[model samples]
Target: MSVCVKGDTILYGSDNYLKIADAADPSNPIEIGETSVPGDIYSITVRNEYAYLADIFNGLRIIDISDPSHPTEVGHYNNIYYTRQIVVRDNYAYVACEGEGLKIINISNPMKPLEEGSYETPGRAYSVALKGNYAYLAATNSGIRVIDISDPSDPFEAGYYPTEGYAYDLTIQGFYLFVAEGAAGLRIFNISNPLNIKQIGYYDTDGLASGISVEGNHAFVNDGIDSLFLIFDVSEVYFPQETGCYKTATANWSSAVNGELAFVASDGAGLYILDCSLAPTLLQSFNIRQAETKMELSWDISSREGITGFKIYRTTNEEQPMTKTTSPTIPITASNHYEYTDNDLINGKSYTYTLAVRDSDGSESVIGERTVTYKLPNIVYLCQNRPNPFNPSTSIECTLAEPAHLNLSVYDINGKLVKT
Candidate 1:
């Protein structure tokens, strides 16, 4: 039910044993080790010389994994009722102990793990991911609960996302938190500032997503209900597009990704090694910059070998289709800045730009259609004092294009300085 990767070493739990493999050659993963442990392993995390395992009933089982060929148990902390997932950082082991909430275990002494603190989660905790001073928990019906672990010995709740579906498992990449929602598919949230979290996007896999892993711009999600593994392009955080999928024999409960290879855990069918290099590396960024009367479109991408170049397309109205503004003109083989300056645009008029790729055979194919508008920068306008001929107090109004703070000073009719 759990899987983790450390360098080229891949470990997955099957029944009551942990299976280890060498995935240097992703196409043919070779088993290297196996270790038996009491209780079912729900999650696994490795750091340094130890592999921390969260057991459903056995609490935390710390295994010595310095040797990938033979992993051995070195410590255990079995006082909790249930431990579903664990995250080890520095000297602490953060355990999602089901109804018992999140337990902070000090593993500075791995052999004698001690409970340092605990946070009462709002719901049944399923998974936990750590970032900086916060620990994010996937609390089933309660959504994602952020626990401030800055003071591990005295953890407290910082915020919550209130997930849309059954939050199962979660992982953190950069400042974004990716959650595997059982029925709601995959949920993505921006945790740049942990306290002020916002949902950025979500992809409905059309099945129960029990586990997920993200690599680069791709997200590998496992669907347990429909026996499928889905991959999505999350380069655009607001709109995650499903670019690939693989159907398994049985239910795929959990999965992990290492570069171009994906390791999946199939309930009864065993581990699945898949080649994920087929997923295309796409445009990393596309932006629009506006000048007085023209807009400059800039974009850059990876793997420019098989492509000819880029073709710029434009449209002024949504009802009207986009037309190619120029031929295939941006050579990307050795250039870093690929841009096109579209001129003669009218002020205050909004135009949308679409980016397409001209294939080798002179055929234009849409890589992905996206819109960026630097339409017009806002201008600050100060309206004449309202109710000009007012009595003691008059209303003054001002408009700003964006949010900002400013000071206003009032002067008397005789040109005398007044209150501000």
Candidate 2:
């Protein structure tokens, strides 16, 4: 079984039925509708008003989900290979056809999904992720194959990375790609140079890594055999470490993320929703306050246990990288609260701060984030011109705490307004 969340609805595939449930309350999913299919549904991807299903032997089936309670089949394409996974992006649907490899279908018209192109890989294509014009495919034993989908009619392989274990699934974030390599665990690759994809780091998970989902600086993966859902801190792309693990009853196949909640799919145990908002423990209250030109951060920990200390990170741009601002705090057995101040920050710039707690075993987990903007002084001040003697040009500066409209006039020695 597989599931995908869209808006307030959770679309899932079970046996030969495509079930649609209202996920207003993710804890208790209410099945509102279901559509029957000829073949067993392996994966489903919903985009806009359509739900694209990867029907095992029946191939791709597009259903019109404009009305949640009454879904009607719009289009379909039967193929020879078993379609295991499907991902819809823009006007294209990338299908991971088990033995047939990657199949690209044009879905510009919901009533008619035509085959655009396909690329055959050595092993079974289990999953796919499309970024820009390239399609990253996880071909079971063949590892990861990067295909240029720039030309949908003729998709060609651009690069390949062979893994020791079966590459079950993958997800991309920024310049890094996270792959769930069966028993080999979660493999992190630097895709900045897609042609030269290199493995930077890896975390040996306890069980078979079947699926993965990335949110912010964390990656949630499922261990199929152990029925465990694992969370890793991927903030340091080159050094991913496991932070938390949740055990389920059955085989955990895949995971989907929405906000702080992780929707997991377990083969026979059914669906499970996990609260991944914060670390398992160790964090109490984390806050930030602005004092004049500096920003102060304070956090409290309820339990120390095997924890070593905490590390603080700051970033100016959300898209840009983050930097560690302070050294790791010294672990104290009695202290519960700690404080740090970021001094001499440029005024009018926004900053984001994250606090991570480290364990005695060298593993770290991000606890919280605080975003604050530094403002100018409360009173306006105009500085004197840099050069006393006039040259062609001199720098003039002024500061304002609040928004304002002001006009500056420049006068010559004659006292006549020359420039404004």
What is each predicted model's overall lDDT from 0 to 1? 0.83, 0.84
The TM-score of predicted model 2 comes to: 0.71
Error of 1 at 314 (Å): 10
Superposed Cα RMSD, model 1 = 12.8
lDDT of 2 by residue, 1-420 (tens): 788888778887778888888988877889999999998888888888888888989999999999999988989988639888888887889999888889999889878788999999889999999888888999988999999999999999999998888999998888888999999999999888889889987888878999998998788998989999999876556557566889988888877888888888888777888889764434557789886556888888657777888888888874468864576574555778888888757778888887777778898766667788888667876878888666788877765666689798888899999889
Q: Which regions of candidate 2 fall more than 4 Å away from where they truly are?
A: 280-303, 308-420
TM-score of candidate 1 versus the correct structure, residues matched by position: 0.74
TM-score per candidate, chains pooled: 0.74, 0.71
Highest TM-score against the true fold, candidate: 1
Candidate 1's residue-wise lDDT over 1-420, tens digit each? 668888889999987899899988876789999998898988888888889998888899999988889899988999876788888888999999788779999999888999999999878998888999999999889999999998999999988888889899999999888999989998899998898899988877788998888999898898999999998888777667676899999988788787788888888888888888888656677888776446777787765755778877788764466754686466656874587888656555567676777667877645444555544457765768868788887887765556689788888899887988
What lDDT does candidate 2 reach at residue 405?
Answer: 94
Separately for all candidates shown, the number of backbone clashes (residues 3 or more apart, or on different chains) is 0, 0
